[model samples]
Target chain A: MRWLNTRTITPLLFMAPVLVFAIVFFFLPVGFSLYISFHKWDSLSPPEFYGFTNYVYLLSKDPQFYRTLVNTFVFAGGTIAIGIPLALVVAYSFSQSRFQTVWRSIYWLPMITNIVAVAFIWKFVLNDAYGMLNRGLALVGLPGPGWLTNPSLSMFSVIMVFVWMQLGHNMLLVSAGLQSIDDTYYEAARIDGAHSGNIFWDITLPLLKPTILFLLITNFITGISYFALMMVLTEGGPAGSTNVTSLYMYNMAFSDLRLGRASAAAYILFALIFIVTLIQLRLFRRGGVEAHN
Target chain B: MADAGGIVRSRTLGSRALTVLKYTLLTIGAIVMVAPFLDMFFGALRTVPERLARPPVYFPQTPQWDNFAQVFREMPMLQWGINSLITTLSVTVLQVTSSAMAGYALAKFEFFGRMTAFRFVLGAQMFPFFLFIIPMFFILRYFPLVGGNDIFGKGGMGLLNSYLAIILPFAVSWHGVFLMRQFMMAVPSELLDAARMDGAGEFRIFFTIVLPLVTPGLATLAIFVFVYQWNEVIWTMTVTRTAPNLQTVPVGIYLLRGAYVEEAKMSVQQAAIFLSILPVMIAFLFLQRFYVRGLTAGGVKG
Candidate 1:
C-alpha cells in the first residue's frame, strides 16, 4: 500500500550516501584498479591490454618486487615479535599497578600522536652522533651504532620505533583482554597452591591466547602494509633495506608514475595480506572464536 | 613488637616484592613512552648553536622559548593549521552524520537487500586503502565537471588541489557505519513505535529520540574519526603533493623536510612539530575514556 511504499522509499533515501560511497569509493576504484592491472598505461596515454604481464613481471622478473616483499614480511614479523610480548607484559603489570590513570595516559600518548611526528621524533632521538639514545650510550662507554643511516640496522630501527609508538595502543587492547579474563580462574589456581610462574603459564597464558592472536594478526597486517615511518625516516634508503612492498608500491605509483604496474603491486600485496589473514584465522580458529565473543 | 613486625614482614615479602617489581616496570615503561615527547619539547626550546654542537646539548640551558612563536614566523603554519582543522572537522561531521543515518536504516528498517548492504559494508572494509590509491587518484583527476574538467572528466586536474580532495575520500567510514549500527541496536524499537503511534515521522523519531540516546556512541565515533583523520597523512600527502595550499600540518611539516635539514632551523622544526601535535594531545587528555570505551567495546580499529 501507500504506507509500505513510504517505508521502502524512506529506507532507500537513508541509504543514498551509502550507495554513492559504494560506487565512487569502493566499486569504481576497485574496478578501475583491476582494469589498470591487466593493462599497461601511464595516465597520459590510453591503456593497452597486456594480459598477465604486470603480474608475471612482478612475480618473476622485477628485481625489487621480491626483495620488497621479503622486507615487508620481516618488518611485519619484527613488529609483532617485539611489540606484542612487551605490550602484554606491561599490560599485565599495569592491571595491578598503582596510579592506573597516570601510567595509561603516559602510554597512550604515542598512540594519539601522528605517525609523521612519531617518525621525526625518533629521527632526532636515534641520530648517530647528536641523538639522545647514542649520547646516553656514550655516557655508559658503549658504542653507538648508526641507527637510521646504516644499511643493516635500518629495518631494525624502524621496527623498534614502531614498537615504541605502538606499545601504548597494544598495551591498552591487551589490558582489556587481560580484564575480560574471569578472576575465578586466578582464584582457583591460587587455591591449588600454584606458584606465580605456574599460574602465568597454566592459566593466564591459555586464557590470554585469544587476545594475543588478535593482536598478532592485526599488528602483522598493519606492520606489512605500513611504510610511512620508513618513508619519513629513511625514504627506503640504505640500499633499500627498509623498503617494504607498500612503500615500493607508493613510490611506483607516485614517483615513477607506473600506475599500471603499481596497481598490480597493490593487488599482489593485498593478496599476500589476505592469504596470511586467512591462514591466521584458520590456525587460530579455537582462540579466534573466543576473540569474536 | 619486633617479633610481630618481623613475622608480618616475612609473611608479606614475596607479595611486596611482586608489587614493587610491577610498579618499577610500569614506571620505566611509562618513562620510555613519554621520554621522546620530552626530548621534542626540550629540543624545541634549545638554541640553534646548542642543537648544532658536537654530541649536541641535551638540555636547553637558557631555553629559547622564542622557537615556539618562531614556528609561525618560519612557515605557513597558521594556514596549515586552518587546513588541518577544516578538513578534519568536515570529515568528522560527514562521517558521523552519514554513519548515523545509514546505521539507523540498517538497524531499524526491514527493507529488501538490507543484509546485502550490511554485508557489503563489512566486506568492503577488507579491501585495504592501499589498493584504491592509484585508481582513486586518476578517478578524482578525471572526475566530471569539477576542477575545470569537462563532461567526460577530461582536460583538468579534477578534484586535485581542493579541500574536497582531502575530505571526500574519508566522507563515509565503513567502520563508523558498523559501529553506529551497534549503537543504534541499543535503541529500543518500542520508543520508535511509540513515536509512530503518536504520528511522528521516521526522520523526526530519529532526530529527536534515537539521536539523543546514542550521544555517547556518536561521541565515541567522533573521537575515533577526529583522531584518525587529523593524523591521516598518506592519502592526504599523495593528493596534496602539488597543492601546498591544501596541505595539513603533518603533510606540511613532512614535505617541508628540506627546511629542517639545516642545523639552525632544526630547533624551529622541533618547535613546529610540538605545536602541530598539541591539539590532539589536548583532546585525548579530555576524552580518553571514550577511546578506552570504544576499543574495549567493539575492538574498534585505531
Candidate 2:
C-alpha cells in the first residue's frame, strides 16, 4: 500500500504528535474560545446563549475595560518608544566595546530569570520608604517618589521594570543587526573623513532600519500582551492604574467567573493586535523592508 | 593608513571621547541590570531583627544563610521544586521530540498535506497564550474519563489539579517546530537517501542520523523550552490555585504571599524567589550561546 510505504508512513508518524496537539490544544481552544465568547458561562451552570451581549457590555458599558485598553496602549507605546531606543544605544555600545561577553552575560541575567522573581526584586528595590532606589536617590540629594504606590507613577514603574527585563533581549537582537552590516560601508565613510556621529546617523542607522523595525514590531506585540510582571508586582493595584487589559481579563475569568466577558475581552485585544500587525506589515512593505531573512 | 577596523576605530579625539563615554554608559547600564539581583542576594540574608528595624537595614550583619534552608523548612518548597522540575522537564522533552520529528517531516518530506500543515504551524504561533487560557481551562477541567470525570466530563474536576493540565498544553511548541524546520532544511537530502539505500529504516535513520545532525538546533530549542516552562506562571497558577500540591516554584511563592506578611517573612519570600530563579540562571550562564541563538531566532521572527 502507498500509505504503508516507509516514506509516507514515516512522515505521518513523525507528524502525529504535533498534529494531535495542534488540534486538541491549539485549534480547539481557539474555536472554543470564540464559541464561548458569545455565551454567558460561569462553569457552575449550563452556558446561556447570550449572543452579542458580552461584546456589547464590554464596548458600551464597561469603563474598566476602556481604562484597561488605554492602559495597555500606554504601556505598549511607552516601552517601544523608550525601550527600543535604549536597547539600540546599549547594543551599539555593546557591539563596539571590548569584554563583550561579560557585559552581555550580566545584562542577560534578568531576561532569563522568572517574571515573579523580577517583579519581587524590583518591588523591594522600589519600596517607597526603604527601597535601595530611594536610598540611593537620597544619596544623590534627590527625592524618591512612590514607585508602585502612586497611581500616576505605578504604570510607569511597571513599564520601566518591563523594559529593564527586556533590555538584554532586544539589545542582543540589535547587536546582531549592527554586526551584520558590512564593514566596507564604514571603511568607505571613514576614508572620506566622515565624523562618527555622521556615520552613525547616515550609515549605521539606515543599515540597521530593518533590525530596528523588527524589534519595534515584536517588542510592541510583546508589550501589548505582557501582564505577568504587573500581575506579580502591582497586582494591577494603586486603584487599577497599572491594570492592563490582559490582567483585567485574567481577573475577569478567574476571579469574577465572567468567562464569556473575558473571552470577549481577549478577542477584542487580539483583534487590535491583529490589525496593528497588519498595518505594521503594510508599512514595512512600503518602506522596502524584507522581513523573511 | 586606517586599518580594516572600520569607522568605529577612528583614532580622532572625538572618537576617543566617544569610546570613553560609551564605556561609562555601558558600565552604568550593566550595574543597573545586575544590582537588583545583588540586592536580592543580600536581602535574603537579613535577620528578622534587622528586617524589622525602623530604617530597614540594607545588608545583613551575620548573613542568615539559613533562610534559604528555612524556605524549605517553613513551606512545601521541596514539593514545589519537584513539581516545577517534573512539569518543566516533561514539557521540554515532549516539545523537543515532537518539534524535531515534525520539523524533520516538513523539511524532508513531500507529503500531500505538508504545505497546509506547515502553514498551520506558522499561523498558530501568532495566537497569544491568553486567548486560550479560558477555553483551555475548561477543556482540562471537563476532559472526559480522567481525574474522576465520566465520559460526559461532568462528574469531577477532570485534569484540573493534575500535572497533565500543566504539561499537556505546552507539549508541542509552534516556534520550536518552526525553528527546527529552519535548521533541518539546511541538512542535505542526499545523506538521508544514502542511509535509506544502506537498508536503514526511516525511524532508524531518523533517530541515528537526522537527530544527531540537528543536535545544536535541538540544544537551542531545549534550553528555550526549559527556561520558558520553568518560568511559566499564569496557566499553571490558574489550574493549581486549589491544588497547591501541583504548584510550581513561582506559583507556590506567589500564592503563598499571605504567609509572608511580616518583614521577616518577606525575607523568606525573597530567598524563595532567589532560589526559584537560580536553576535557570545557572543553566543560562553555562549555555548562554544556545540561549542567545534561541532568543534571537524567536525575537527576529516573532
Candidate 3:
C-alpha cells in the first residue's frame, strides 16, 4: 500500500508539459539566437560564420548602438523618476481615503486599456496643427511644439505616455503595500505626536520599501522595453530620437534583415538588463534580509 | 492660556486647509488619468470632418452611433476579435497549467539539478521579448513535423503565421512558473503529510488541497497572461500581416487608418478602434474584482 502511494509522481506528471515547453520553446530558441549571433544570417540566406565580427562592430564602431542605449536609459529614467513617485502619492492618498477602491480602479484603467488605442488617441491629440494640445495652447496663448514629430520632444512625449500607462499598476502595488502595514503602527505613531508629514516619512516610506523596490525594478525592466508605443506613435522617427535598444533590435532584425547584428544588439540589451537587475538585487537584498532576519 | 488657545485655533485652521488641499490635488490627478479616455470616447463619437476640424472638436455635434456598425462592415473585425479571443484564451489556459505543474514540482520535489534549473529559468526571464522574436520567428517557420520535410526543417513554412506559431512558443512563462512556485511553497506541508498518511496519491493531494488553496496565484497568472497576450502588439505585428483576416485587434485597429482620419471614413476608424479594444475593457470591468485581487496577491510577494 505504501509502495502504491501516488504522491511522488504527481509533480512529474504535472510538470511534464512545462518541462517539454521550456526545452522545445525557450531553451531551443535561445540557443539558436546565440548560435545565429555569431553568423551572418539573413532571412533567406543560409547563415555564414562571422565569428565575433558582429559583436565587435556593434560594440566598437556603431554610434547608433550607443545612441539607442542612451535613449533607452533616458526614457526609462524619466518614466521611473516621475511615474513611481506620482503612483506612490496617489496610492497613499487612496489608501487613506474612503474611496480607495474607486480611485485605484480609475488609476488602473489606463494600464489595462489597449496601448494601440491609447497611442492613436495621443497621436490625434498631439498633432502639431490640429492637435488637442495645440488647440488648448492656442486658447491659452502659448506655443505648442510638435509633440511626436519634434526630435527634442518626441522621446519626452513617449516617456510621458509610458509614465501614464504604468502609473496605475504601480499605484495598486504600492497601495497594497500601504494596506499591509499594521494599523497599530499608525496608532502608535499618533500617540507619539507624529504629524502627517512625519507619519508618511517615517512609517509609510520605510515599511513600503519592499513594494517600492519591486515597482522600481519592474518599471525599469518594462520601461526599457518600450517598443509598442514607439512603433505606433513615432515609429522611431524624427531622426531616430525615440529609438530605444529594443525597437532598434526589432528593426534591425525584421526590417533590415541583419539577423546577426540584431542578435548581437539583443544580447547587448539583455546584458544591460542583467546588470541592472543584479545591481538592484544587491541593493535590495540587504534591506530584505535585514527586515526578515 | 491665551497661547494654548491660539495654538488650538491654528490647528483647526491648518486641518481645514489640508483637507481642501488634498481634495484639490486628488482632483488634478484624477483629471490627468480620466481626460485621455474621455478624449478617446469623444473621438469615437465624432465624424471624420468633425475629427479634423480646425480647432479639433472636443465634443461631437452628433454622435456617430453607426460608426461601430461601420467598423463591422469595414474589416474582418469580427474575425480579428475571434482571433484575439482564441489566442488569448488558449495561451492563458496553457500558461496556467504549465506554470502550475512546474511550480508544484519545484515546491514538492527534491530532484537533482532542481535549484540549477530554477535559477536558469529565472535568468531566462530577464531576456526581453524583442531579443527572442527573430530567432523565435525562424524556429517557428522551420520546425520539423507532420508534412513532408527534410530533417533540415524546410518544406513549406512549418509553424509561422499559424495559431500554433503564437501559442506553442509562449505556452510556458518563466515568471508564471516562478510566481506559482513561490505561492505553492507557502502552503503548509502538514496538509501533504496528512494526505500521505491517508495513503492518498500525490496527484489526489495536489488536486484536493494544493490546487484549491492556490486559486489566487493561478488567478493572478491567468490575468497576467490575458492582459499581456491581449495587449501584445510588437510580436503579433511582426508575425501577422494583411488585415481583415489574420490580424489581432491591436494590429487590426492599427491598419484602419492610412495617414488621416478622413482617409479611412472617420466614423469607421474610430468605431473600429473602439470595438477593437471593447472586449478587453469589458472583460477588465467585469473581472475588476479578480484583477485587483490577483494584482494585490502578486505584488505582495513580487
Candidate 4:
C-alpha cells in the first residue's frame, strides 16, 4: 500500500522540470498576453490600463487590420485547398507505386530546408529584372508579372511557397493513411467492377477522413503562423498586402513597440484559432489527443 | 483468342495513359520543388559577369566547387556551424528529456490537475510565439538573478546575447510533450504492472522500461526538433544581435546576405546559403528511415 502511494510522487518528481518550465515560459506568457491586451503600453512608458481600447480600435478603426485578417484566411484557405488534394493524389500514387521511397525523399527536401533560405532563393527566381520565370515566360511570348513585388500577385506568391514547403509532409501523411487501407477492400471493389475513381470516392476518401481532417486543422494553425517565410520573401509589402496576422503581430510588437496592441491582436488570433480548432476536433475527432510511443 | 488479345491490348493502352498523366504531374511538381535549388546552386557557381549579364546564367558551364571555400574565407562559416550545432543540440536534448518524463506522467499516472495540465499544454501549442517576442526579449535581457541589478532587475544583461538566451526560452515545447505522452499511452499497461510486481521503482519503470519502448517515437521528435532548431532565424536575430559568436548558421547566412557590398560577393552569399543548408540536406538523405517511421508512428499515436 505504501509503495503504491509512493509511485505517484515519483511521476510528479519526474514531471516537475517540464511543469515548471511550462508554467514560467509558456502558460505565464499566455496569461500575461491576455493582461497586456487591455493596457496601453509601449516599451518606453509603463503600461496604463485602457480596457477594451486596443480591441475596439482593431475592430472598427484599423483598416490594415481587416486587410491582414482577410489575407491570412485567403493564404490559409488557398494553400490548404491546393495542398490537401495534391497531397491526396500524390500519396495515392506513391502508395500504389514501387518508387515511393525515392519520391518521398525528393518531395520532403523543401520542408526541412530553412524557410528563410528557400524564400531567398525564390526571391532571386522571382526578381523582376532577370528571374527565371520571366525568362521562360518571354520564351513562350507571355508576360511575366512582378511575382513578389507586385501587390496583386504577392499573396499568391507567398501561398505558393507555403504549399511547396508543406506538400511533402502532407503527402506523406496521406500516403500513410492510404497504406492503412486493407488491400482486400480494393480487390472486392475491383470484383464489383468499381472504377478507380469510384473506388477512391467511395472507400479511400471516407476512410481517410480522420487523416485529412488532422491535416486541415494542423495546416490551418500552422498556416496562420507563417511569418517566417514572409519575413524573408516580402517583409509584408510593396504595401501591407502580404501581411498575415502573425506578421502583423510581429511588426506591432517589435517594429512599432505597440506591445499592448500586439498582445491584443495575438489574443484575438488565439481566440479565432481555438474556436475553429475546437469545432473541427468535435466534428472530425482528430488531433485532440496525443498519438505517439 | 483474338478477342482476348484485343482486350489485353486496350488495357495496356489505358495503363500507359495513366502512367503518362502521373509522370506529367510529377514532372511539374519536381520542377517547382527543384528549380529554386538549381538556381541557387548555379548562381553560386556563376562568375560575377555571368550573374550580372542581361540574361543571367541559367546553367553554369562548369560547377564551381571552389565557391564553398571562398564562402568559408569570407565569413566565420565553421564558427556559425559550431554555434548552431551547440544551440540546436542543447535545446533538442533538453526538450526530449523533459518531454519524455512529462509525457510518461500524462500517459500513465492519475494525478490531480492532470487533465488541466494536459489542456494547458495543448492550448499553448496554438498561441503563436511571435506575440511574445518583444516582452520575451526584454525579460531575457533584463531578468533578475545572480547578476547584479536593481530590485526591478533592469541593470545588468542577465541572459541576453548568450547561447543560454537562444536555448532556454524555447527548450520547453508543449508539442513535444504532447507527442511523447501520446507515444507512451500506446504502450501496454501490463508492462507497467509487471514491472511493479517485480519490485521495480517508478524511476526504473520509466527509464529502463518505458523509455526503451518509446525509442522510435523519441527518434522522430529528435529529428523534428533538430531540423526546426537548425532553421530558426527570427528569435536568433532578435536576441543575439550584438554577439557575432553567438549567431546560429541561418542568422549568419542572413547577415552575410544583408552585408555583402561587393558585386562579386553575391556568389559568396549564394555559396554561404548553400553550405548553411547542406548539413540538413545530408541528414535528410541518411535519416530517411527514422524520419518516415517517426512521422507515421507519431502520427497514428498522437
Candidate 5:
C-alpha cells in the first residue's frame, strides 16, 4: 500500500534537484565562506587560523578599505540621486505616450545587452580625444572635461553609464506602479478642480511613494555591490578614485590570492547591506500607511 | 496626472502646449536612448583612416560590412560563441527543468516538509552573488571526485576549468522556482485529482497537463535565464580565467580587451560587440511580450 501510494516518494523525487542545489550551492558555500573568513587561505596551502586579524585589518588598519567604502557610497548615492528621479520621470512619460512597444524596445536595449558591450560603447562615447561626447562639445565651443581620466570625475562617469544602462529597467518598475493607480482616482481628482500640476503632486506622487522607496533601496544596493562596469570601463583607475569594496574584494581573492582578508571584507559588506535593508524596512514600515493619506 | 488612465480632455491651449512639450521630451528621450547604439553601429562601419582622423568620424564614409567578418579572424569568435551557447543552453535547460519540477512538487503535492522547502527557497534569494563568488570557486575546486580530485577533494583541479564549473552553480534558479510555483498555483486541483483517479501516473499528469498550462511562465523564465546567462560575466570570468578555451563571448572580449582597445581596431571591436548583442536582441524582439509580463510581475513582487 505504501509503495502504491507514491505520495511522499514522488514529491521527493521531483524536488531532489533544487533541494540538493540549495544545500550545495547556497547553504554549504556560505558556511564555508564564513569558516574561511576566520582562517588565512591562499588555496595553494593549508589554511592558517588567523582568527580576528582579517576582520580587524579591514575595519581599522586599511586605508584603501575605507576609501573604497566611501567611493562605493558615493557611487550608490550618486546613482539614486540621478537615476531614480530620471527613471521616474521617463516612466511617467512612457505611460502617457503612444507606440509603447516601440518605445520600450528602444529603451530596454541596454538592459538586455551585456555589461562588457555597454562599457565598450561608453568608453568610445566618453573618450576625451576623438570621442563623440567631446567632439560634440567642441562643435559648440564648450570645454570638454575628461570624463574618465579626471580622478574626481571617474566616479561620475561610472555613475552616469550605470544610470544610463539601468534607466529602462527602473522605468519598467515605476511604470508598473504607475499603472497600478486606478483611473477612477484620477477622475475623482479632476472632478475636484485639481490642475495637472497639483494632481501630479498630490495624488500621483503620493501613490508612487512606495514604488520609489522600493526602487531607492534596491538601486542603492545594486549600485553598492556592482563593480563589473568599473572593471571593464575604468578598472578602478585614475588613482583608485572609482575603486569599490566588492571590486577590491574580488581582486584580493582572485588576483592577489588573499582569500581570508577578502572573505572578511565580503562578510563586512554583507553585514552592511543587511543592516541597510533592516533600517530601510523599519523606516518604511513606520511610514507605510502614510502614503494612503 | 491629467493624462492618468487615458482621460478625455477638451483641446485647451495650455493642454495643447503641454502635449507638445511632452512629445518633445519623449522624442528627445527616445533619441538619447537610441543614439549610443546608433553611434556604436556607425563606429563599427568606419574605415581605419576615418577613425584615426582628428575629431574622428561621426558616420562611416564607407561601411565596411566585412568588419563583422573580421571579428572572427581577429579572435576565437566561433569558439567563444560555441562556448557561450553550450554554457547558456545548459544552464537554461537545467534551471527550467529543476525549477518546474520543484515548483510543481511544492504547489501540487501535500508533502510533510513542503512549508520548510518553500521557506528555504524564499530565504535563499537573499544570498547575493557576491557572497558566493569566492567560496563557490573553492567549493567547485574541491568538489570530491570531480575533475580528478581525490575523495577528500584535494590534489586536483576538481570541476574548475570545465563547463561544469560554469553550469553547476546556476543549475537551480530560486526565482524561477518561485515564479513557477506562483504559476502552478493557478491550476485547479480537481483536474489533477481526476487524472489520478483515471490511473494516470504523477509524472504523466505533470508532463502532459501541468506543463502545457504553464507555457507562459516557462517562456518568461526561459528568456530571463537565457539573456542573463548569455551575458553573465563575473562568475564565468572568474572560473574560466585559466581556461581561456572555455571563455564565452563577453568574457573573451573582456579578457582580451587590449587587442581591441585601440582606435584602429575600434571598428572590429564595435562590430564584435554588435554581433554578440544580435542573437539575444532578435530573440527579444520576437518574445518581448513574455519579457514585459515577467518584468511587471517581478516588479510587483518583493
Candidate 6:
C-alpha cells in the first residue's frame, strides 16, 4: 500500500515496456545502422571500418543511386502535385454531396486494401493486351499505351496508382477540414454577391490552408519512403525506371549483399526527408498557417 | 412580390444545377475507383479461352467459382492466411498493450524524464522504417541463443523464419503511444485519485477505471495497427523470403507471381488477391468510424 503513490515509481513501472522497446527496437537499431553505414559487412564476415567510403560511393560514384534519387523525387513530387489537388476537388464535391458516408466508404476501398492487392489489381487492369483501361480506350477509339511495361510510362503508371490509392484518405482529411469552416463565412460571402467559385477560392482555400499543408507534408514524406508498391508492381524494372531509393537500398542490402552501402543510402535519404520536413515546418510557420488552424 | 419571387426561383435553380453537377462527377469518380476491383473479380472468373481472346472478355461467360477453390489447391493459401492472422493479431495486441501502459504513464503519472520520454516518442516517429530494416534484420538473424546461435550470436538464423521476426520489431508503435497519450490526457485525474483513496492498486485502477475509459482509443489504434500489419509486405517479405512456411498472404502472393504466368493461372492469382483483401475489407466495413477517427487523430502515416 505504501508503494502506491502516484509519483515516480508508478509511472516508471508503467513505462518500463515502452522504455525497453525504445532502447531495443528504436535506439539500438538506429545506432547500429549508423555504425554499419561506416563499416563494410556482409552477414558472414566481421565488419571492417571503412570511413565515409560508403557515403562517398553512393553520392558520387554510384549512377544507380542518382537514378533512384531522381525517381524517388519524381514519385514524391508527382504524387503531391497531382494527388493533393485531385483529392481536394473530390473532397470538395464529397463535402457538398448527399450520402457522404456511402461515397466515402466507396472511395476508401483502395486505401484499406493492401499495396500488393492494389498493385496486382492494377496489373490486371493495365495489362498491355487485354486490360480494362486498354479495352475502354479501344471502345472510345483511342490507342492504349503500355502502362506498366514501357520504361517511359512505368513511373507514370506507378504514380497514377499511388495517387488513386491515396485519394480517399486525403479527401477524408480535406473533407474534415471543409466541415470545420464556419457557415457564417459562406453566408456572408453570398450576402456580398459572391459566386460559389469566388467563395470557394477566397474563403475555403484560405481557411483550409492548414489541412492542405498538413496533407502536403505528410504525403511527401510517405511518398519518399514508399517502395512496397514499386517492389510488387514493377520490382524496380522496365530498365529500372521505376526504381526508387528505398527499393534500391533494399536490393543493395539483400540482393547485392552490400549491407554497409545500403545503410548509407538509407541515412542519406533520411537526411533529405528530415531537411525537407524542417523546411515545410518553417514555411508553414512563416505563412501563419498554424495560427489559423 | 413577383420580382422577389423570380430572384428566389433563379437562385434555387442555380443551386439545383450545382448539386446535379456534383453528384454526377462524384458518381463517375466512384465508378473509376471501384471498377478495377470489379475487373479483378471478373478477371478471376474468366475462362482460359475468354482470357486469351484478342480483345479479351470483360465478363465471364460462366463464372469460374472454382478459381477460389483452385487457389487453395495450387498454393498454400491456408498457410498464408494463418500466418497473416498470427502475425497481425500478435502485433496488434502487443502494440495496443504496450502503447496503453506507456500512454497511461505519460498521461497521469508525474515522473522524472517524462518530457524526455514523450519527446523520444515524437522524434522516433519521424525516423522512417527504412532506416531500421537493415540492422533489424541482422539483429534478428544474429540474436544469440534463440535459433541455435552460440553465446556470440554466430549461427543458425537467430529469430528469422518465425512469427517473432515479423512481430517483434512492430510490438511497440511510436504513433500508437503518442495517440494513446493524447486520448488519456483527457481522462479526468479526479477519478484515479478517488480510486486510490478507496484503496485500489495502480494496476487495478488502470484495468478497471482507466482502460475502460480509453477503450475507444484502444479500438481505434487496434484497427489501425491490424490493417497496416496485415498488409505489411516489405519487412515480412524480407525476412520470410526463404521461409515460405512463414509467408503472409501479400508476401506469398507477390513472391509466387511466377506460378501464375499462364493465362489459365491468372484467374487463380486474381482470386487469391480477392481473398487476401477480404478480411480487411470486412473489418473496415464494420469499424469504419473508428478508423476515420484514428486517421484524423494521427493525421498522417497510415
Among the numbered candidates, top lDDT falls to: 6
Best by DockQ: 2
TM-score of chain A of each: 0.95, 0.98, 0.94, 0.93, 0.95, 0.96
Query: Which stretches of model 5 miss by more than 4 angstroms?
Result: A1-5, A287-293, B1-11
TM-score of 4: 0.93
Could you give candidate 1's per-residue lDDT for residues A77-173 as a string of tens digits? 9999999989989998998777788888899889889988998899888988878888889989999999988999989999999998899889988
Error of 3 at A173 (Å): 1.8
lDDT of 2 by residue, A1-293 (tens): 65778777889999999989988898789999999999999989998999999999999999999999999999999999999999989999999999888999988888889888998899889999889999999999999999999999999999899899999989999998888899999999989978889999999998888888888888888888988888889999899999999999999999999999999999999999999988998877765666644
Q: Tell me how candidate 3 scores on lDDT.
A: 0.79
True contacts kept of each: 0.66, 0.73, 0.59, 0.55, 0.62, 0.73
Q: Please, what is the whole-model Cα lDDT of each candidate in the order they appear?
A: 0.88, 0.90, 0.79, 0.81, 0.88, 0.91
A136-255: candidate 4 lDDT, tens digit per residue: 898999988999889999989888888989889998888888888889998999777666668889998887877887788788877876688887778888798888888898889878
Q: Considering only the true interface residues, what is the Cα RMSD of candidate 5 after superposition?
A: 3.7
* Lowest lDDT 10-residue stretch of candidate 1 chain B: B293-302
Q: In model 1, which regions exceed 4 Å deviation?
A: A1-4, A288-293, B1-11, B300-302
TM-score for each model: 0.96, 0.97, 0.93, 0.93, 0.95, 0.97
Q: Give the TM-score (0 to 1) of chain B in model 3.
A: 0.89
Q: Which residue pairs in candidate 5 have backbone atoms (N, alpha carbon, C) closer than 3 angstroms, thus clashing?
A: none
Q: Is candidate 3 or candidate 5 better by TM-score?
A: 5
lDDT (Cα, 0-100) at A113 in candidate 6? 93
RMSD, every candidate, angstroms: 2.6, 2.6, 2.8, 2.9, 3.4, 2.3
DockQ of 3: 0.55
**lDDT by residue for model 3 (A94-213), tens:** 776766666766787778878788788788778798667787898899999999888999999988888888888887888888888999998999777676778889998998888888
Candidate 6 at A133: error in angstroms?
0.5
Question: B189-241 in candidate 2: lDDT tens per residue?
Answer: 99989998999998999899999999999999999999999999988999999
